[model samples]
Every structure is written in C-alpha cells, then in structure tokens.
Target: MELPVRCFVKAVRRCFLSYICLAVFCGCLMGIALIQMIDGSFKMDIFERKQNVTKPRTTTLETPVHISPLRMKELAAKRANKTDLKQKWLNERIERLNKAAQKVQMRREVTARPVEPSDKFHIFYYAWYENVQYDGNWQHWNHEYLKNWRKLDTKVYPTGKHEPPDDIGSNFYPSLGCYSSRDPITIDIHMKQIRDAGVGVLIVSWYPPGLSDGAGRSSDLIFSDLLNAANRHKLKVAPHIEPYNGRNPVNFLTHLKYFVRSYGNHPALYKVKKNGKESTVYYIYDSYRTPASSWKELLSPKGNISIRGSAQDGVFLGLLVDVHHKHEIKRAHFDGFYTYFASNGFSYGSTWKNWKTLSVYAHKNGLLFSPSIGPGYIDTRVRPWNSGNTRHRRRGKYYDVGWRTAISAGADFFSITSFNEWHEGTQIEPAIPKSTNGYTYMDYEPEGPNFYLNLTNWWVNEVLNKTVHF
Candidate 1:
C-alpha cells in the first residue's frame, strides 16, 4: 500500500511539471505575437486578425490548488500589475525603434534633398490688410458681417464691423495682430515665412494703380514694397488680376503692357517660358464672366488683338469655377487653368475627390492642371450663414491629406490657395490662441503655431528628394 501511494505522488509531480513546460511554450509564442503586433504597421493588423482565435488556459482558477478567496484576488492583482509593466516596457522599446528609423531617414534626406524653394510651388498672397499704426486705421480687419440672403430672419447672422487688434473678421486670429500689408518689417517677415516654407512664387492680388477692391485700399500701392521684400528673399512675384471695374481681355492686355513698362525689370517679377517665348505669368480671376471669343481675340496667336509674340505676352492662368470652364479655358486660348476656391467642392474645379478625373482630362487635352490646396476654410465669422463651406482644420491633418492626395493623383505642380487670406480662415500663416470680447478663437492645438509651415517644408522636401514618387 505504501509503494502505491508513493507512485501516485510521483505521477502527480510529473504531470505538474509537464503543464508548466506547456504554459511556458505558449507564453513564448504570445511574446513573439506581441512584438510583431506592437510594430504599428499594416501587417500588425493582419497578423492580429489571423491570431484572434482564443485557446483557453487551464491555469490558476482551473487548477486543483486550494486557496482563500482573498489570496486569489491578491495573486490576480499581482499578475495584472506584471502585465501592465510589461506593456509599458514594450511600448517604450517600440518608440525607441521608430525614432531610430526616423533618424536614419532624416540622414538620407539631408544628403539627397535640397531645401531651397522650387519654382513648381505657387502660393496665393493677399496684401489688402491695414492697421492704425501703419495706415492710420484698420481696413480688411474691420470687415462687416455679410448678410445671409437665404435666411429670411436677418438677425440669424450677426451685423456690424469687427473691432480690430482684439476682435478680427477671421475665426482664427493672426500671430501678427492687426498688421498692415504695407509695413516693410511685416512684409520682410512674410517673405521669410514664404521662403522658409520652400514656396517659389507669390501670386499677389492685383488691381490697377487707382482701382481697388471693396473693404480695402488698392493692392497696387503695395506692389513695389512686396517686390522689394520678395527680391530680398530670392522669391518671385506674379500679379493675380482681381475682378475689378472695366476689366476685359483687350484692356487687361494693355494693363499687362503697363505692368511690363512699370515693374517689368523688377528682379522679383516672375516669368516662365511657354510656347517657346519668355513671358511673365498672370492669373485672371472670374474669367468665366468674359466671353470665350473675347479672350481668344487677345490670346490667340493670329487673333485681331493678339499679344502673342509681343513683349507684353504672358502665360495666363484663368480661374476655373465650374465644370464647363474646362472647355472654355482651352477655347479662350488661355495657357492653363487653376482651381482657386479654397473650399473643396465649393466649385467643380476645387473638389479634391474629382482631381483624378480632372487631371486625366487635362492630360488628354494637353492643358496644365494645377490643383489648388488650402489648409482649411472657415468664413463663418464674416459670412455667418456659410457654415457648410467651413472646413475644419483637424490639427494640421487637413493640410497633410491635401498634400498627399494631390501628389498621389499625379499632380506635378500645385498651388496653395493662400498665404494670408484670413477672412476665409485659409491662411497657413501662424495663428495664436485668443479669447477676447467673450469670443474664444480656435487654434492649431496639439501642434505648434508654425506647424503648417514646417509641414509644407517637409512635403516639399519629400517630393523634391525623389523619395515620394508621384
């Protein structure tokens, strides 16, 4: 009887040892799975799906060992603490590995990529702002609250002009509080910002010397100052013809000659070679309002008022607002077309989702398609009823997607909708946090103020480095 009892005890000991070995083997497998899973790649998700099957462990509670309830709880807590510690350590390890990979990539890019601005990048620039310090009073910053025509109750939208220096027209306040565009110091700072972002040209809003837009003075007065500042930074400047009084193709051609005669020799005046001729580039806003025949008369090489082969000839980019403008631009004999509206899908040409189709069509027709990108759009403060058009900036994610999608859609050249069109809240210029007059302004939270600029520089380098293939 004694020998039998001893044999049973030996058998139990052997069985217990076998279970421990099996559990250790399973734990090793789990550790390997965790390592692969925590790498944070697409493969991790796929691996997780394949290994989702659960194999129950007959340990602890299922074991025949006897223990008080309190003792069991303490053991379970200890086990949980151990798991949490392991997870924390694992995450730290993964983070270190990822940082190391980024360091290697940065080294490679430093050797391969040039940080200088590329001519392919164009930024829409506005110079309509004014302030008391520079101009004796605020201009666009005191923008009036626009009426919402659709709403019968006018009270639905706020009325009156915005008070400057504290309350501005924009939803996001600028870092430069109530700054005047004519300020040389401010202009220099702007040029440096543009250059830092690797932007090559500033497509400035322009009207004739005396002509001006509503709510602000004529931008023409500031052109010389802009040109000087831009030249200092080795940046080019192009005139963006705004829709103003008495603007037609013939008169616009005359204005082109005027610009040539006036600022033609300015070092900052941007010129591009096209159709085997050297000419400055110009953007015609609201071009759809003009008849195609009228433009053809001015742009066609053999037309009655053709500027072709002349000194004032320019590579003109017409604003594309609707789908039919695609054919009109070609018919009008314009050099190219650009989608200007920052609000994506607000116009047929500005829709990001339609860019692939648009690019394909442009390629087939042999026209250059420059898809305009905006960081975000929000004019709700000025146009209170235009909430549908407001595109929230998801802490810089919005701008990132715009860059990625544009490049992925085979866009070789693209334009930013604005550098400082603050009225539309599309400005990539730095913005700061503010709460004034009981209004809390939005900011680029989870990111620094210069995040957009840094991001633009990064994307520009990524493309120019030949690392990210279009």
Candidate 2:
C-alpha cells in the first residue's frame, strides 16, 4: 500500500501470472481423469477405420481394463481362441452350403448323362457279397470279426458275427442296403454308376471258379453277370487275380487258359493291342506273397514256364507294399506296379510323398505306374484293433488330395481302390446316412449319397483334359 505505482503494477502482474498457471494445471488433471473414465488403455486413435475386406470378420479391437499382466495375457489368449473358433465355424458353414448347392446342380445331370469310356480309368469291383433276397441267407453282411491284428494292444477286439440288416460288418451303410453282387438289378445299377462316373474298366476280384476268400462265397457266377452289365455300359472288364488257396505259377497258367476259353470272346473282356500284339490285362493281388522266383517262371521270357510268347499272355501288374517289392517287381518281370492301399501312409508304396520316386523308378524301368486312389479307409468294424490305418475323408478334401498326387506323379492310368469293397470302407458307391440303436454309421454328410461318384466324374474330366498320356 505504501509502494510506488510501478512496483504496485509488477506485484499485480506476478499474482495474475501465478493464478493463470494454477488454473492450467488443474485443467490438465481433469483432462487425465476424463480420459481414464472413458477408456482404461488410453490408446486413442482418431482414424479408427474398418478393414477393406469383401466380408469383414467380427473382431475385438479394444484393449481390456487395467489388470494384472497375467490376467491380461489370459484374456488375450481367450479372445484369440474365440476368434479362431469363429473362423473355423464360418469356413465349415461356407463349405457345407457350397457342397449342398453343388449337389443339387449335379443330381440333374447324373442320371441323364453318361460319360464315355476312355479305358484309362479303372475301378476295383467286388462280387462276393450275398443277401437273403438274392442268396439263401445274409452271407457277407454278417461278416466275422477277424482276430486282433495288433497283438500287443490289449483293447477289446470284439469277436462274433455282424448282425444285419439292423447291423452290418462295415462302418459305412450302403444306399442300396445289403444286396447281392449277382442280382441283375444291382449289376445294372452298378454299371450305370461306373459309366456315369466316366470309368472305363472294372478290375473284378477273381478266384478259380469255385474258390473265394475268408468267409466269402464263390464269385465266378457274379463275374459273368458283371461282364454283361459291363457290355451295356461299354466298359471293359479285367480280372483281379486274388491269391486263392492254391495260387501258384504252374496253376496260374491254367487259370489264364481258362479265362481265355471262358470269357475271352466277350467284348467286355479288357484287352490291348500293343506293338502288333493283342492281350488282356490281369491285376495280380498280393503278387509278392509268392516268391519272385515263382513269378519269373510265368512272367519272364526265358523261364521254364513262361507266358511271354503265349497268345494268352497279357499285361501283369503286381501289388507293392514295401521298398523291397520294387526290386521284386522288376526281377519278377511284371509289366506294372500298383499301390493298392487306401491309407496314404499305410505302406511304402501307398505313401503320397513316395509317389514321385516310385513313378520315376517305374518309368525308368519301362514299367507302367498306376497309383491307387481311394475315398477313405476304415476297417475297424472288421479289423477292430487295427485303427492305425483309418483315414477320414474330411468331407471331400482327402479324395481331392489323392487325385492331385496321382496327376502330379504322372500316373499312366488311374485306378480307384474300390467301387464296392465295403469291408475296408473304400467304396465310392452310394451310401445313405443310417443310424441304428447301438451305433451310427458313417456317411458323406452335407453331400448326398452320390457325392463320391460326382467327385470322381469331375476328376475323370480333369485327367482327360490334362496332357498326361494313358
């Protein structure tokens, strides 16, 4: 109050400056408090743009409330897992819908259209099945469970017979129900399926006229019907020489003669004219079961009992199980090799990764390379303990992968493992969704009964359009 006018002005200026600074500090604290109240993370972004995808997926974009680091990590993991689950579910739903639409479109063409035979596609056909309607009783439907294959495993190997029609031996149920192979209607239907699928040849399982495999009946009569049906479909027939009770090099010649005299005149008997020579084709199943020395006697030109120069001589293919079979096949003078197992990694021959090496070996050795393709494999119903070889179809992805591998391996020809080998669950024939009291059977869900047939038709076209020469 007693100071000069200039000093009084300076004091007033300092007091105003200090008051303004205090007010600014108070405002900053309130701003911080307001931000915390809104979002704990405080990771504000002015440009919070949406993703530019065709169908933007729902995702969590904000951070959690303040918590322990461990708790935060756990929450993040849960969110990530949830996102992954949503993605998987969406993908499956899309696939199912697409297949449903595709199924509807394909059904219209399936029955009306018939794909012509290229003779490059072969399908393994079976004829041992029997039913009460066609045969006297349910012969093969009530199949016996084989002894435990895995001796070391102590799992219950359920023994006894498969009680059908409520129950059957296979894990899959047929769309046609339990039917006989000899039934005329069944044969016609099978022929139509094969023709519609663009298959050219049927490698029918064969045994000497009256012989068969374990718990199976003679199939020679059924084979005759198959020939007629094949004729109607304009498809060729090749005999799959199964290892019967007394199959040997000496008797094989006789069998060959019998085939020539028996069904040789039929137009459906698959034959080829290579280098001015005409002959039929024979698939030797479990060919390695016999000694390579034994096979040489029949296949080699200079052997004591050779079929090389004979008129009945034909192309011979052997089953390959292991690496040694490679040398065995060559030494035995086989015309070709086929990896028949449906499970991809079940054996050295069946492995997808081994196809290239095998193909190269076959080509270098002047042997035909025909890789076997299967929809899937599951023999748990018959061989209960041997679950290691089971292959799940995963809708249709498994089959597509098989086709891709075959084409990439430069397969000389494509052979489906089975059209109806129900015991091993490798059939591509129609199968309906069926469930019984005790268990539910496997079916091609979402896709119809003819799913594999349609899928096969697509692949056959793919192979034909390709530059691969059969």
Best candidate according to TM-score: 2
Backbone clash numbers for all candidates listed = 0, 0
Error of 2 at 62 (Å): 27
- TM-scores for all candidates: the values are 0.75, 0.76
The TM-score, computed over Cα atoms with residue i paired to residue i, of candidate 1 is 0.75
Model 2 spans > 4 angstroms off: 1-114, 467-470
Q: Encode model 1's per-residue lDDT on 1-470: one tens digit a residue.
A: 99999999999999999999999999999999988777767777777776654533345756455568999999999999999999999999999999967964553244222479877899999999999998998999999898787756445668999988898899988888889998888999999888988999999999987889877788888899899889999999999999888888768877788889989889889988777766888888899899999999999898899988888888888888888898999998887888888787798888888788878877777777778898999998899888889888876667767877788777746789889999999988988889988999888764657767766777788777757643
**lDDT accuracy of residue 50 in candidate 1:** 69
**Structure candidate 1, residue pairs in collision:** none
In candidate 1 the C-alpha lDDT for residue 151 amounts to 55
